[model samples]
Target: MTQDTSTRTHCPYCALQCAMHLQPGDDGTLTARPADFPTNRGGLCRKGWTSAEVLTVPDRLTRPLMRKDRNADLVEVDWDTALDHIAERLLTLRAESGPDTVSVFGSGGLTNEKSYTLGKFARLALGTSQIDYNGRFCMSSAAAGSVKAFGLDRGMPFPLTDVGTSEVVLLAGANPAETMPPMMGHLSAPTLIVIDPRRSATAQAALAGGGMHLAPRPGTDLALALGLLHAAHIGGHTDHDYVAARTTDFDRAWEHAAAWWPEHTEQVTGVPATQIRAAADLLGRAAAHRSAYILTGRGTEQHSKGTDTVSAWINLALALGLPGRQGSGYGCITGQGNGQGGREHGQKADQLPGYRKIDDPAARAHVAGVWGVDPDTLPGPGRSAFELLDALGDGGGPRAMLLFGSNPAVSAPDADHVRARIASLDFLVAADFVLSETAAMADVVLPTTQWAEESGTMTNLEGRILRRNRATAPPEGVRTDLEILSALATRLGQPAQRFPTDPDTVLAELGRASSGGAADYSGATPQRLDDGEALYWPVRAGSAPTPRLFLDSFAHPDGRARFQAVEHRPPAEDTDPDYPLLATTGRLMGHYQSGAQTRRVDELTAAEPDAYVEVHPDTAARAGLAHGQWARLTSRRGHTRARVRLTPTARLDTVFVPFHYAGEQAANNLTNPALDPTSRMPEFKVAAVRLEPDPAP
Candidate 1:
């Protein structure tokens, strides 16, 4: 493809942000080809190659829609009518109740400019403190843990290229093989130690590569982490000099892990004691050579004690002197396309631009100055994502909401209850490229431009700011999200200049707003990004981008990392005789979150048409379940049915299900909503379940 015919952009799916070229054909067709980039190295996953198909799906929404009443069907309408009605309803709700009665919900897939604007509009136009995004459910536990340990949170402190030079890589609850096939190229040279409940493809790859795989029981990763630390201490692998010089509270943290001996941890986690010791030895040896990395994913950080679980692993990393080293550090494998940037901007309930605490007077003043508003005019921190959703339409809760780019109906835990709460809202407005499950329930739905149709910037997993160039024009009836937000702000009596539709102008304003904060993007201009500059943030104006962090000192005031005193705990709900099995949820190779876009693609749907329960053969036999037969998995929250697929790779006491399907097949239907106190992340990794066979007709 010639440069004139192809537009350089990143994939629209996961955080890897694999670079690709969108080439337009003579017949008005678009195709995706892998482009050379550091993260993916000229390789594309199946999802990335087929992503263009979603742009032309049959059900793609091309017109604004509105419903006269809750019981009525949504009818096509003009953009002016839809925006005018939505703005009027929002004003009425705010005037009748209060500004706090209106809320805004955002998504992780939004571009940096859009995420920044959504947060600003929620505070300035709607004058509401209730704003959060789906990203709170993605990696909040890891973000919280990282902040507690290092005083800052970036998904990866170093570039992805560092992984190739590591002697050993321990994946705690992460599976790159299926979720991000392109990332597997980096792991081929490392001694892979995979820790997961299921023998995922990553674990299989680890064993086949002469590495190790530790299959712990569901929600028992904290114990396993503590065991590794204890073994490291007893094995004379603790880096005493590094701990004394660069860290604080080490003694207190070590006290928490001292009691978790290998034997005891093995008993709790269902892994062999010998294997636990061996894994510890490998990590310690590799770290001593300064050639090891520890990375975590959703499996270990989706429990009621998720923050502590992540802290336990961080403690182990610190004991081995991992973080802040050249090739050795602890990081989180962020899942969403812009998950790192989505939370860093202002979408989170408790944050302002640049990952600044909204409650901080200085942060508020700085951002308010950029918006030309008084600092006190901005509301204080509001409820988190789940809390915000749970309180909808209740007394003293938000009555009206504006949602963008998210579908919580099929993705949220205790989904039936979330849907009920959504239904109870007095008014709801959704902006999307298609009629998603959540959008289907909205009083007004605004058709918006999607990935290739919009030009913007996204911060990838490595914190690098990359530009997404518009490859083709959007349908005439649809508008960009920025235009939708800008029009609503104008209708709310705000000047057009206050909320710009041009991405370049918004990004410049965002730079000013984020100038002095932790995730500073002051130097990431549209011109610089489009000029092919690889800018990673905390980029102050007139300064170079920061690629790696914490070489000589941590972000804390004392220039030292702090160790969190974390201990192991049982899951929110333990198994009983009535519910003797544990059910866990995860992603499939063919689909993305909530299955909104990928499900619309014929190839993706054909590869995985429906969700299925992965059960161990022994467990299946005990439950009288046979392969290909329908099984009803019931939990305290609700039940979902799926065809059984018996495999020896599954843990004997645990069952696994992909969480991409909707309605009866949704894995989230059986998940618990018990939340972590610190991060407020729900227990999506484990739920007590009972299985019964129901043969399909």
Candidate 2:
């Protein structure tokens, strides 16, 4: 009775999660059309248009595969055999080593239901505290910063639609122009301020006529933000009345920013004093008018000082009295598809499903009550992502790992090291639709259904939960991740009542688990999402959706935000005689993270076939490098080879590389694993490197 029917779902890519409709072709293929959802509003990015191609890729894993012996090739195996083998190994590993010897790694792309189940399975079933997700690399800094300031983290306190009505939009280190093209429409503000090291597409647009682009030196965003605050203070642009009434510790914040005047900030950041003054003036005008927003992206948040950098920006917003005002505030531009929701559902190391602290006895009891477990049995928080990976096979670290949905071999910082560590594990398992680079090294790889083949829910960047309905049946032999987790948990002696495979059943439990927490989702249900428009979180049952936060008061106990005094700090690695240039990593418009899924699509790969480095003309000349010539980029840790593209967009002392490829072209090979203390986010945005020409015979 299956006919070519059209189903509505959101894009499987970024946090924008643009809505789209899918129609099945006679050849069992699918095509997409823009859905009239409020977020994207019938707009589709290139990745969205070509997303369907992955569903039919020839190499899509359709059966469970296992490597019986170490160094042996993975052979196709039946589901029962694969599950039994993995369960036996896990139990044996636990019996030999303690439960702490086993760990679980998740992804930001997992749905709320999947994330909830994964976290519960790790704690309740596996009885391990070592569980975290790829989101550790994405927005952990922003989350940490927001929690320190407003006592909560929700990506954007207000919805995306608010951007179009704002009088000014200060976009720091975010290039949505290429990453989320459709988002450009929301940049309808009269003035757009873009802060970045290069003349990114978004910066170029701002430079054209929209507003201004402050091209600060790498690792100097903190200085620039502090300089702006200083300028506002000296120029009498701060809203003293509002600051005094709604914020605390303003005197310390002001003193910290006062140390970095325009002249001093210019010297440290490499941005002219005049530009800083102009940006401060524009921001001042916007604040006075009560219509502006300050947004942060990976460029500002992926660093050793990421939390401090975000805090610096938050201090500036508080000085101008922005956060709690209507149509005026600060937010983080989340990158991954479920980056907002994934963290809320408890996949993070120190958090529960409600975004509550894992160490909080009250939170532990609440979640334990929902899971029917004793509160004292829940384990304590574990190590962060990189630390967890680096501990693999160590003297007293995790010996067996269960990884799902992420391809750390290409996406993780110091990816070469991560891949080697993963290879050194006693046992590694990966569940993914494609045989990604990480999966290729696993002892067991489970074939799982992807976006259109699964029924679940994802929270967009706006904190709105949208349904991802099953459009068509998954290919034979492939199963849902929920099903895989269910089978494995049961095989591990867990009762069926605990690990349910049905999405709705898991969601019902999640709703109760997340109730009364920061990211409350008790109001949203599968039936509601299917019948009505997407609803934002914190919507308790019978309550309306909360599209805008902090409208009247902040999340703090006293209804006031805090202003932390943060000073500029040096990057983890600085350029020196050995590594005379800086290397920053990012993404391209054509390829998504790690290129695991997008690389399989013919169109996307054809558009960006190989990885390349962006070098400044002056830097290229000094190195005797030409455009399109292969070059070796050597960092303190390791080196990588990429084709060099000379352009003035790059600063002379810095080089840019896209972290999407694996093998010799992997940019993460040169990235620094130094992490931010507060957020544990690695300094993926900046690393010291040296470029040398490779003589291609």
Best by lDDT: 1
How much does each candidate deviate from the true structure in C-alpha RMSD? Answer: 1.1, 1.5
Runs of candidate 1 exceeding 4 Å displacement: 1-4, 695-697
TM per candidate comes to 0.99, 0.98
On residues 30-76, what C-alpha lDDT tens digit does candidate 2 reach at each position? 99989886668789989999999889999999999999888899999
In the predicted model 2, the residue pairs found to clash are none
Query: What are the runs in model 2 whose C-alpha is more than 4 Å off?
Result: 1-4, 695-697
Q: How good is model 2 by TM-score?
A: 0.98
Give the total clashing residue pairs for model 1.
0
